[model samples]
Target chain A: MKILVVDDEADIQPLFLQHFRKELRHHDFEFDFALSGEEALEYLKGNSLEVVLILSDINMPGMSGIDLLSKIRQDYNYLSPVVMMITAYGDEENYKQAMEKGADDFLTKPLDFNLLKEKLKKVMNNG
Target chain B: MNFDYILLLIVFSYLRRALQSKILLPKIDKYLAIGFWFSIVLLIAGFFLKFTKEINAWIAHAMLFTLIYFCLTQKEFKSVKSFIYSILPFVVVNFIEDCIELINSPFHDEWNNYFDTAIFFSIVWFFAMFFITRKQRKEMEKEQLKAIEFEKEFQQSEILKAKLETQVAERTAEILGQKEKLQKALDKLKTTQVQLIQSEKMASLGELTAGIAHEIQNPLNFVNNFSEVSSELLDEMNEEIVKGDFEEVKNIAIDLKKNLEKINFHGKRADSIVKGMLQHSRIGNNVKEPTNINKLADEYLRLAYHGFRAKDKSFNADLVTDFDENLPKINVLTQEIGRVLLNLFTNAFYATHQKQKKSGETYKPMVSVKTELKGKGIEITVKDNGIGIPEAIKDKIMQPFFTTKPTGEGTGLGLSLSYDIIVKAHGGTITIDSRENDYTVFTIFLPTE
Candidate 1:
């Protein structure tokens, strides 16, 4: 499975790669990282719908995670990625924002990777 | 005859007749006034002077007394008492004259022969004294009438002065009343101005808080996600160590150390957010600029919806927006107005979300935003299918610190701050329409010009 991670911070790339080490070794998952929503959109322009999953951070430098979700819902909705939004506040506002923009799931930080993994498995199983 | 002599005879005839009429003389049958005058002339010309001289001075006194009685007894005189009073001065004069005559007669026997002269002088003196007393009395009566007329005029002026004073007092009271009313109106205006200022403060605070919330949440996302994944990595390393996989364990520790770095980085990022919050507040000045209101409203509405979904995954709602194609861009404070839109959209979603909870899956939560062209301005409406605001709290919804959301869930400043931004700052209007358990719609009117 190919997955995309969109965040403004550079630190997230290393963290995501390390966490998914077992899956990558087994060829169970492949990952791509974009520093911003604009970068993510640029990358997707070349490789449309190749990534099946999208994990995004709500706050970003240029276009926000919600904006990316909206663009994805608009352009890639026919053969779309399962989009999930991550939030730090666990604030209801961001939760509703993610859902309103067609987010398939949402997680609050400090994220419980176990819960995230379980949710991913369920989405994957359901898909 | 000479003219003077004839005129004097005619005058004497009239005077003699006048005296005869006063003495109750008999009237003739025809031309009685002429007959009396002719008879008086004949009697006087032929006999009066002769008889007056032959008669004693006592008989002359009796004739004069009768003339006086007739004159005084006239209707205009009112009483004969005054005619009798005329005799007093005459009687005193008569006594003085008699004493002089008696002394003169003893000194000169010729005084008896000149007695006619004495009588004539005494009669002239008596008449002159009577005329002087009458003239003095008439003068006294004229002065009394003048005093009465002056008193009447004084009384009329006093009444006029009193009326003028009443009018002046009434006009003074009217002016004081107008001044008092103006003061009260000024006081009311000041109160409204104060309320507007307070609302502005609340709006600024709301904008600042949203900034702080958005800034801090991102780093925290990183910090929390890395910490959560770290323990799982440690577990993996422990399992790898049991399999004697030292290289894998080393890789796991490195991953764990990297994760810790991320946590540290994001932790500091959150700390920096605190400093940034202060800076945000200090720098916040609402400056208006040209903005496409439709794009702005759409963006904030999406943000609000997603933010709500992030907190409660089970919560769901449909958001719809209808934008006028002809709507023009207008100048506005972007951040402040953005905060107001965010707050309104948030409330719409929250209300519907609450209703969805009670009504279950059959209930479809829907929130809509609509913008239209309204003369000289734009009208935006935010509507939702939700458990409506109760009638009791409706009026107070825009008041500061008044909230229906439970204790920790809401600060209750959302609507009030939004009210300040849209209505006070923008010189706009906000009105609400709602029904219990039905729906709520908030209409906003903003001037484009």
Candidate 2:
């Protein structure tokens, strides 16, 4: 399975890779990273079929996570990648908006790697 | 003649008493009293011992001379118009006596009785004249007494008026001194009031702590995540070393080192943010230092944006900045200029936020900051596409305690304090350009030398 992780924080790339080192080593999952929602869209446009999962941060300058989510759901709906929103704020409004915009799951920071692995396994089994 | 002389002695005594009482002529009064008593004694002696006509006439003439001498010796009596009248009776009696004596010598027995009756009638008429003159003198003396009393009263009143004027002058000087003291106190109070308002402005900046906390969270998140990742990478490195795979261990070690560097970077980022906040909250030392205007403008702009974001999570606006790279560092009180920038940015954000709420999705709230190197100085402008300031209140925006915001929502001292900081403290100029419901631009010029 291939995954796309989108966040404004550049450190998120190394942190994600380290957390999923075993899966990356075994070639069980292939990961790509983008620093912003705009870069995420550009990545999706090039490799929409290869990416099965999209994990995106909600808060970002220029384009927000909700905007990205709605764009993906509207523009690339047929590709049908499982979208999960990650945010510092786990407020009910953000959760409801994410759910309404076709988010498959929600995650709050600081992210629990164990739970994230379990969710990824579930998505792998479902896919 | 003897009756007339006795009457003249009585009238002279009465005149002396009147002069003493009304005009206070003690010396003349004593002389008149002595002459009157002596004449009485002489006349009584003549009546008892039968003194001859020659001796009797000599005593009467001597008494008349004494009375005239007393009256003439007093300067007060000499000035009176009534003095002549007082002496006329004595003169007439003496003249009539001489005439009768002369006529009797020519026809001694035949005309003696007729001449005696004529002398007696002449004495009666002069006596009446003397009484009338005495009454007139008394009235004139009473008028003179009234004039003296009036003169004394006028002198006393003049002294009292002088005393009152002096007191008034003293009181006026005292009042002027008090007025000066009050004016100084008022000036001191005004300065203290300005300081209090300045502190109040700082207190409002304290509200930015919430936004700072939010800002700190981002770097803190990275620090936590990177540390966790580094720990996991260390565990993997140990496992690879146990497997005798030196290449994989080196790779893990490199990853760990990168993670540590990231942790350090993020930690320092958080530190700088905290330091910036502390600098803003602390009171300024009012010392001028060479500072990069661009960096100051950018830092405050972010602070204001994040501060607003922390309050209204739904609010977001495009923050556009065009800082001049070639601009020279200018001398300014860092905290004071920072405060001015923060105020302008915060106000811009507020205006846009308000317009966003009212105009909804159609309004794209935008705040832009630009710095340029104008002639002899640096020019900074903060422009906002928000609900612009109304034309009527444009000039009043920089007045202390003047606000268009709802009560309690704003301190209203933001622009006023900014105005003071830029114009008064730093010797800069701040100007505003705004149009209702369109846009607002605040331009500041700080000279460099």
Candidate 3:
């Protein structure tokens, strides 16, 4: 399975890679990274079929996670990948908006890698 | 002869008493009394000795003339008109008596009846003179009573005037005391105002606390994650070393080293954020220190944005910063200048947020901060693409207690206090340029010296 992780913080890339190093090394999962929602969208446009899941942070500079989610749902409805939103604030409003906009799951920082791996396995099995 | 002397005595005594009481000339009064006594002695001698009638009459006339002289010489009667009116009666009477005696000597039996008539007329004239002197005395007494009343009224008025002056003095002292009390109260109020301003600075810091937490959280998250990864990498390295895979062990070692570096980097990031927060909230002595303007502006810009974001999670803006790299450090009150920058950045974010709410998705909120090295000074510019300040309120924005924010949402002292910090405290100049519904730019210029 291939996953795209989008966050404005550049360090998230390395952290995610290190946490999933076994899966990445075993060829069980492949990872792509984008620094922002805009970059995520650009990545999805070029390589939408290869990515099976999208993990994105909600707070970003140019385009937000919700905006990106809605845009992806509207533009790529036929190739809809599972989209999960990550946020520092786990407030009801953001959760409601993300759910309403078709988010498959929600996560809050600091991310628990064990739980995240379990969720990723579930998604892999479902897909 | 004795009767004639007695009659003259009676007339002289009456005149003396009347003049003595009214004119009040002590010397004249003594003389008049002595003359009266002398006249009495003359009468006694006339009775004792067998004097001729003519001689007796002559002696009586001499005594009468002496008394009249005394009365006429009195100050009250010294005027010719008064003397003629009062003493002329006695003089005419004496003249008539002398003429009658002289006529009787020529025709004794025939003039005897005329002599008696003349004596009766002289007696009437003396009575008239006595009455006139009594009326004059009464008039003088009335004048003296009026003068005494006038003196009494004058003395009472003087007492009243003195009382009024004293009252006025007391009232003046009282007013001065009240003024001094008011001045003291005003000074106390001024000190209270200074304390309130310090609290306001703390309040702004309180507003930034949520943002500061978020800022620190990001780095903290990285620190935790990186350390955990490094520990895992160590475990992997240990396993690889046991498996005798030197290449993989070296790779794990490199990864571990990178993770450690990241942890250090993120730790320092968190430390700087905390240090900035401390500097902002510090109640320093307004001491000027060499400071980098760009770093100050950039730190505050991020802080204000994050602070705004923490409050309204949906709100976001494009933060653009243009800092002069070669700019020299200038002396400034660091905390004060930081506050000024925070205030400006916060206002910019607020303005853009408000415009976003109104204009919806069509409006992109943008706040840009720029610092430049101008000649002899530095300039800082904060620009916002939002609902700009209206022309009518542009001039009032920097005045204390002037605000566009809703009640309880703002204390309205942000810009005013910033103005004080930038302009008065640091000898800087702040100016605003804005167009309603378009944009706003706040520029501050601080001298290097």
Candidate 4:
């Protein structure tokens, strides 16, 4: 399975990479990264990667995770990749909006890698 | 007339001077001056040897002039009686001189008898004048004293009245000052009331959000778990079918039945999350109860951190807990304090997170929560290794709507509400200590009883 992780923060990339390095080594999967929702959308276009899961942070500077999720649900229905949202905010309104935009999962920070793994595994297996 | 008579007149002057110096003393000097002038004129007239009767008449006239001068020099001139008293001594001297002349006369005739009668009539007039002058002087002195007493009384009353008025004015000013202070306090109270209402509204909203999230997450977790298990079973079935293992495929179908039973398990979880939300939104509920502090603190801290983790996959913070095991249970509204703790922890994480971003430093940011039992009170300290609060803003941080966080980054009511909860509601104290570029500690002391 191929997963695309979208977040605007450069520091978050390293943090995520540090936590998932062992998992990356063990799993028969590849993870792609995008610094913005626009970049994630652009990467999806003309790309031959068989991406099965999407993990994105909600509070991006441009094009939030919810917007990307809605776009994917509306425009890329054929792909049908499972979408998981990450956010620094844990407010219910955001959770509701994300679910309404077709997000398969929602997580608030400081994210526990174990929980994230369980969620990702479950989402990918289901997808 | 005689030495005794002269002694008696001098005694009268002395007594009058002692009783009323203002009435008697004015004529004293003038009488002495006239007496010396009349004695010199009497000796000179005798040496010249004028008609014996004529010389005696001259002496009488001189003596009368001296008496008239004494009368003019007297303090009181109220009536003719005062004038007669002034001349009474001169009249006695003249009658004695006339009796001596009558006894020594060369011819013993009726002329002597006429002289004696004239002297008798003068003595009667002098006595009448003397009594009238004494009455008039006494009246004048009494009236003068009465006027003086009335004037002194009027002056004293005026002074007392002025003093009383001044005291009243001072008291009035003091009352006005107190009224102004009370007015200012009332204004402050009104402002605080408005702020309290606004904070309560926000707190209610936070409670609703937390409940809704809990409800949604429960069912969501089960759906996620069940779906993964089903997908795994399907994958296993597909794998066995590809390997042409008919027995393995049949076995997988049986396993699928057990996974189906778990489907309702996840459904029930989703239902509970929904139920929690409904309960949270309901108003006027009796939710307050005596809660175990150590247990609640641990559970709520876990929930708060995990709740945040449920959103951002990459967000992480180092948290340390040192709860006192022996601390007594506290009575509180559990949900409200839980929300407060969540807010503090979230803010601590963000503050450190922002610093880490700015410094580009790889150091681990630590947030430590510690509880201790001290006497009848429990102290909870939350310390964070974040960009410490500035000295200038330390006092203002607990003020409502005061924040250094960027807009949308914070609601700016966390510390303020936390302060109110601990101080006003729980009868506790919350104090903050911070060192710039080092760390910040928030200490809360709540009574056990």
Q: Best candidate, lDDT-wise? A: 3
Clashes of each: 26, 0, 0, 14
Tens-place lDDT per residue, model 4, A6-121, is: 98655344345434544665774568899988899998885524888888988653366777788888877787888889875677878888898888888886566668878777
lDDT per residue as tens, model 2, B118-226 = 6566556566766776687678788888898898899899999999999999999999999999999999999988687767656667657767776788889889988
lDDT value for model 4: 0.65
Which digits, one per residue and each the tens of the lDDT, describe model 3 over residues B228-312? 8888888888899999999998888888888889999999999999998888877756678999999888888888888888889
Give the least accurate 10-residue stretch of model 2 chain A, judged by summed lDDT.
A59-68
Tell me the whole-model lDDT of each prediction, alpha carbons only.
0.71, 0.81, 0.84, 0.65
Under CAPRI classification, how is model 2 graded? medium
Query: Model 4, A28: alpha-carbon shift in Å?
Result: 15
Interface Cα RMSD of candidate 4: 12.0
| Model 3 residue B222 CA deviation in Å | 1.4
TM-score of model 1's chain A: 0.93
Task: Point out the worst 10-residue segment of candidate 3 chain A by lDDT.
Answer: A59-68
State the lDDT at B108 in candidate 4: 31
TM-scores for every predicted model: 0.43, 0.80, 0.76, 0.46
Deviating ranges (above 4 Å) for candidate 2? B1-7, B14-18, B21-31, B37-53, B67-199
Query: Pick by DockQ: which candidate is best?
Result: 3
List model 1 lDDT by residue over B1-449, tens digit each. 02122323333344345335344544322233553354345445434465543232333334334434544564522332343354534433443444455467573455544554554565565467557656765786688778777887887888888988998899899999989999999999888665654554454445445545655666777777788678788888889999999999998888788788888988997796565334333435667889788987876675576566555544556678899989999898876777677788878888998998899857878989999999999899999999988899899999977889898677777788789888888999999999989999999998996
- RMSD versus native structure for model 3: 6.5
